[model samples]
Target: MSEIIGFAGMSHSPFATLLPPARDGEPGGRFLADSTKVGAAVTELRPDAVVVIGPDHFHANFYDQMPPFVLGVEEATGFGDFGSTAGPVPVASGLGWAIRDGLAESGFDVSLSYALTVDHGVVQSYEMATGGAGIPLVPLVLNTAAPPLPSLARCVALGEALGQAIRHAPDPGRVLVVASGGLSHWLPSNDPRDPSVVGERRSSLIHGRQDARAFAAVREPRVRAMAGNPDAPVNADWDRWFLRQLYTRDLGPIVELGHDKLEEEAGSGGHEIRTWLVGHAAAGLPLVWDSYEPVPEWITGMAIGATFPVPA
Candidate 1:
């Protein structure tokens, strides 16, 4: 009966773009969502262990394979990127074993080839969320940037499985579900006319309205953009639908974070970070930065969130 203490989500690229530039260990790197402010309670709650969910650029950057199919990359393969935490991550074998067995049985390709490197999306955000308190984590990677990546439906299924895995975890203490990456964003040096990043931009849209008219004619295009076409707009439907099924119980957005010009704060890429925590014995969590409200349809997204624990 272990309750999932906190269920959270954010854009994976936020840490990569925001953490490095953060001033004095603050979440100053990104403008759209600030980890320091948003995840303050997670650290304070002091859960026994965390399950960090993130994307593996290898899957997203390339196009050979789609997701729901996980690869245990050869230890020697390098992402050529400097911000990876791929070295000797203390992975929970029980969790890995479960993920492996489950993926294999589900007809998803699961590989345990070489060593896996940790990306900044995990380490940096973890650092901010927990203030480097050194919490043990069972890291799961999403092939967000790779080819043959997992679909939105599959990822949500993975999340449900993750909840089960963590619940089954023998170790005691509360467990937190942390999903990181993506709010609408545009990069620097990006041509407004170029079709390499995102398609036409829309504002003031929240994640609650499921009415056909809410998305009107914009749903499908948004999803394709999210599929990383670079020439399309991100369809919030797939991700939102998955989250709605997995957590919200068909409820609408609980928290929203979005910034118009993330580049202005951290250069290229906007930011969004939202949270969901469910726990019976949970203590009140603190807000890291002063609570902020976004200007209606403004370019910048204010960081807002919710934190509650789920007890066993």
Candidate 2:
């Protein structure tokens, strides 16, 4: 049976690619350096494949038809938005199919895509963790952006199911799971369901797949405009508290924190922590090394963490 070799949870932002920090000492740069360390840890483990659990930024799934969870079975392509990787991403179809079947049997009812297109959410984290080594991967997307999201407890349960699926796969091989996104930041204009959200941006958020290029052209500028905005919120306290829970292997408080309470404490973008919760539950291991920084320039409380590799 294939065993989980390791797990990583990290923050991702377009600015990490589009507007990287100039020096290693800067917040973004420091985060990048730590990310490299995480990548090295992944390399040392020599995983056969990686499963990336991440959130979409409306670049793929939109309000037009959003599912709670999606697993890419056949292939995945990157949108290359904000200068992140574009074009074909290597996929482990055989293992992916096994995971799909296992999830179904486990009562997940996860959505499957023959051809999935993802943006920086999956690409950025995968590239950072693997250093773009082209290791085969399976992409699992969570609906963190849209409302009526799966509850935090549900996410944990989903992760547990995923763990069971991986363990039961016929040829699971050594696998690494990477959870991408969050640390507490806000993107006020992201939710189209809000009454205040109107005009072309709102339409794009709801139906971006219809004309992805146009939506990209419109959305990129707005995101760039927030670069270095001092007023942008990043709840460092909340971020640290969340990390502490992971390190201590006590997720009860986190799982009990409802979605509304999470938003109130960590902001809308903090919803991305759903991915981390999934990764933690799936790996079933306490974090060994973790770091955090509130980077206003990137408009997020940046963080990176990894669990110790399983013994061979």
Candidate 3:
């Protein structure tokens, strides 16, 4: 039988790698130190393949037909935005097919894509976890930015299904399951739905713009601007409380929080935690490592966590 050897979650904040280090005593400084420990564990646990549960920030998915969950079979590649190279990454296709079939048989209507371009979520996670060691990846994309976000309960079920699928893969071997993104974060400027935030001109450019390139031209610049800013808003209290929920192992409070409520409390970026939830459910393993620090420089309530090996 295939086995899940480990699991992890981390902040894919672009600033972690893209921007220079924050000054000592800054929140970013403290958070980066914690991140190094997570990276070190990734090297120590060394898995044959990685299954990354990451969210798309309107980069890969559009509002018209946003999939709550998607599995990239055949292959995967990324835009090379945050200190990662732009190129195709090897994908474990045999395992991908197995997961696609397993989840379907399990009654989860998940989308399977032959071509999916992952952005920072997968890129940063891969870099931090493996340091570009070139491990094969199985990318699972979750839509966190788009409205009508997947419910926390649904995320749990999806994660469980994913865990089952991984075990059933043709050659599960040693798998590193990663839930990439969140603790809690809010970026008022990055909300895609708000025309006012990006200004009416850019909003009009994005309004009903079906061309991916056209939309990206106007959208990506604003995204980069927000990411580069150090004064962006962050809710440290919310992040701390969320971390407490995880440590307590009572996700009841988080589940009770829907997308609307999460947006209000953690900002639009808060929805990224659904990716973390999926990995959490998949491993069904308790947290072995966790660090929470609100880094406004990254505009994310930065955090990371991993699961200990379950006894055979």
Residues 1-312, candidate 2: write the lDDT tens digits.
779987899999988887787876765887888888778778888989999999888788888888999999998999999999899999988889888988888788999999999889999999999978999999999999858799999999888888888888798499999999998998775667688899887888888889888888888898899887766789999999999899866678998889889998988999999999999988988898888888988999999878974221
lDDT for each of the candidates?
0.40, 0.88, 0.75
Estimated TM-score for each candidate: 0.52, 0.96, 0.87
What is candidate 3's TM-score against the reference?
0.87
Model 1: how far residue 246 lies from native, Å: 9.7
Shift in Å, residue 154, candidate 3: 0.5
lDDT (Cα, 0-100) at 190 in candidate 2 = 68
lDDT of 3 by residue, 122-163 (tens): 878776776678888889999887566789999988888989
Judging by TM-score, tell me the better candidate of 1 and 3. Answer: 3
Model 2 stretches with alpha carbons more than 4 Å out? 309-312
Off by over 4 Å in 3: 22-27, 188-214, 227-231, 248-250, 309-312
Among the numbered candidates, top lDDT falls to 2
